[model samples]
Target: MNKISIGQSELMASQISLGIMRMNALSVEEAKTVIETAISEGIDHFDHADIYGKGASETIFGQAFKKLGISRDSVILQTKTGIVPGIMYDFSKEHIIQSVEESLTRLQTDYVDTLLLHRPDALIEPEEVAEAFDELEKSGKVRTFGVSNHNPLQIELLKKFVNQPLIINQLQLSLTHTPMIDAGLNVNRTEAGSVLHEGQLIDYSRINDMTIQPWSPFQSGNGKKGLFFDHPDYLELNKVVNEMAKEKGVAREAIAIAWLLRHPAKMQPIVGTMNPDRIKAITKTTEISLSREEWYKLYLSGGKMLP
Candidate 1:
């Protein structure tokens, strides 16, 4: 797997990261295999959230990771906070500090490589967040800070007060779910794709040097729509993906991941699959690069119209 410098920071991470959101369902042994497989495949970055499996995922990963006896510095661990599940999104100083303390305990680590504010808090006070970040940085609880699911202005708002550079913005992006890309490509058009839902985040992120961590790299769209592979709405997409996979002699998942990696944005996609076999297959994305035309073909095949 290729490595890229995350934002303007010194944190060099793998091009593809493994999301441990589903690791809670796996036993310690199973989780150990998954983590070991990912590490063997050069995936040194692991993404987690405090809300994932109600924190069970982190606990399992910690136990499994400890059992592996690998050096803590060998792999980068990134996790998110600010989401209280059904309650509300809280970026309060107390909540933010408490979340990290709890996450550190669950992860069985002294500090996280990166910590992201899981979601935008509508009631966010940038001052409180800044204070929390200052403390976290000074105390060595978090190495760096970023946000998830935030638009450019939201990031700007945080940037105004937060002293640290917001180095990353994790968002939902895949072949079929590309509002950020669509809004850019369909500029000035009357189509629904022209709607700027994310305030031109792709451009903003690049200009600001914020790495965009694309999550749900296989989902059809937001919510319970499911994966695009073999989905009824993505028959054409599956055809193109399958044909490309056949030509490249790689799994269809690799093609999907390659499409994201092909972008100049240098996106680090978070593959959420826990299957060791699938993890190995997905890592093949680093072995192949899609041509410009092939990349567009996939975009079109995913049911997008290029203006």
Candidate 2:
């Protein structure tokens, strides 16, 4: 795997991050296999969230991670907070502090290299978030802070008080779910105003040097059902992906992953698969390069062009 600097920081992280959200259902032995497989493939960056599997995933990892007993410094432990049972958001100082403590307890770690606010809280108090982060940083509980699914303005709003740099933003990205990638596809039209987050998240992160970790890189949902891997509407795009994969002698899925990392922004595509072979395949994007024409061909086939 290739290393990319996370955000503006000098810390180098693997381009492909591993998500352990689904391991809650896997047996301890099974979880170890999946995690160990990732380690074998040089995937030391693991993503976690507090509410995943109702906290069962963290517990499972705590056990497996402890058993493996890799020194805490060897891995980059990143997680998120703020989505709870009520479908509401919470950036309350108490919740943030408590959440990190619980996550550390569950993940068997002393501190998280990065903690992301899961989503924007409509009523967020920048000061309260600041307060929580201040303490977390001072106590060495959280080394860095960022947000997930947040836009540019929201992050700027937090910066008014958040003393530490919020240097990362978790985004939902896939070959088919390319709003961030496609927002600028049409510049002369007024419709660009209607795009979610206004593409500012991508532009802002790039200019500000924030790392973007994309979840669900291979979901078959962007066309008939919704990003462009398996849905019926993307048959043509799929054909192109297959053709490119055959030409490059790599898996189509690997081609899909390469398309994202090839962007100048240096996005880190986080995969949710527990499959070892798949993890090995996707991370190989760090080596493959796509031609500009091949990249745009898939995007155009995903949508109507000149129609």
Candidate 3:
């Protein structure tokens, strides 16, 4: 597994992340086996969310780790908060503080390696969030800070109040679902479809030295959403992926991940498979580097290329 440095932090993370959102459904022993397998494959970072199954995911992880007696220092746990069900967004100092306390208890850990704001809070007061993060860091509750599904301006807004360094921004990215990349390239004033990203988030992240964590890297960018496995719009792309997989002697997933890793932006794909075998096989994606032309062809194929 290729390692990427987390800003100035001592933590070095693998290029791929194991997302434990579905671990709540798995038994403690089963969950432990999956995480153990991931760690064995040099996957130390685990992505979590407080609202996943209403905290069941964190509870399952906590119970499994406690039973297995895995040391806290060996792993880096990252979880997000600020998404309140029925209610919109939340970044209030009280909410951030309460959420971290709850997350720590559910995860059965003294501190999370990274804490990301799940989504942007419309009424976000940077001061409140900054204060919460400052206290969390000082209290040894959270080691680093980051955000998810946020654009460049939102991050800028948070910067005004946040004294701590925000080094990671997780977003939805795939060869198929890529407005962030395509919008800037396909410039047409008359076409409404040309408006992509509405913000230059990818470039902003790279410029600021923030880690770009791409989730749902295989989703089909078509009429249907989140259906990347054998998706119709993804046929050509999957074909290329399968072909490359055979050439590289790795699984098809490796090809999909490579498509993202091959980018100049150096994206870290957040892998969500619970299967240990899949985890080990997908890490090979980082090993295979697709050529520049191959990456572009796949990107153009995802869209009806304009003349």
Candidate 4:
């Protein structure tokens, strides 16, 4: 897998991340195989969330890591917090501190390599977040901090008070769900795609030296419809991706991910596949990059247009 330094941090991580959000559905042995497979394929960074399966995903991954017998220092562990299911978003100092403590215990580790705020809290107080981060950093509970699904201004608000570097911003991005890219490419147009939903997030992330981690790389939309692989609505995209895969001599999944890797923004794509074979196949993305024309072809095939 390709490696990149996250933000200004010295922590170099694999460009391809293994997201264990669905690991709670697998048996311990099965989860171990999946994790070991990812490591073998050069994926050292794993993404988790405190709310995934009500924290069962982290518990399962912890058990698998122990059974795999790999040294803790060999892999990078990142997890998210602040989402309390259907209740509310909590960035309070009390919730942040307690959450990390719980995640630490569940993962059987003293500290997480990276900790992220799972979602933005409408009722956030940056000073309270700063206090929580100070405590976590002083105690060595979290090495780095970041956010997810946050707009540019939201990050600016946090940066005002938080002393630590906010290194990552994980967002839902795929060929078919690219409001950020659309807004940038179709500026000043009256089309729906030109409406700036994310406020130049792609540009902001690049200019700020923050890594944008794209989750659900294979999904077409909000994921309510499912994978776009053979979806009838995405015939052109599927056809183009399949052709590219054939030409590249890799799986179709690899082509989809390569589109992300080809971007100059230096994105890290988090894959959620539990199948060992699928994991190995997608790893091919780091080996190849899409040409400028090819990249645009795939983008247009996704039904996005340029004015």
- TM-scores for candidates 1 onward, in order: 0.99, 0.94, 0.94, 0.98
Of the candidates shown, which would achieve the greatest lDDT relative to the real structure?
A: 1
Each model's backbone clash number: 0, 6, 0, 0
Tens digits of per-residue lDDT, candidate 3, 1-307, equal 7788875467788878998888988998999999889888888889999898799999999998888887889888999999998878888989888998999999998899999999988888898899999999999999999999998888888888898878899998877778787666667755544686548777788899888899877667644676565776567766777776788899988877888888888777898888989999988776678898877876766654642
Write candidate 4's Cα lDDT for 123-209 as tens digits.
999999999999999999999999999999999999999999999999999988888888998878889988999999999999999
RMSD of 3: 1.7
Better of 2 and 4 by lDDT: 4
Taking all chains together, the TM-score of candidate 2 against the true structure is 0.94
Report the lDDT tens digits of candidate 2 across residue range 203-289: 778888898888877765444353456667778878888888888888888998888877888888888887778877776766789
Q: Looking at candidate 1, what is the lDDT of residue 197?
A: 90
TM-score leaderboard ranking: 1, 4, 3, 2
Q: Rate the local accuracy (lDDT) of all candidates.
A: 0.95, 0.82, 0.84, 0.93
State the TM-score for model 1. 0.99
User: Candidate 2 — which residues are off by over 4 angstroms?
Assistant: 191-199, 220-227, 304-307
Off by over 4 Å in 3: 188-193, 304-307
Model 4 steric clash pairs? none
Cα lDDT tens digits for candidate 1, 1-307: 8999999799999999999999999999999999999999999999999999999999999999999999999999999999988889999999999999999999999999899999899999999999999999999989999999999899989999999989999999999999999999998999999999999999999999999999999998745488999999889999999999999999999999999999999999999999999999999999999999999999999888888
Error of 3 at 228 (Å): 1.9
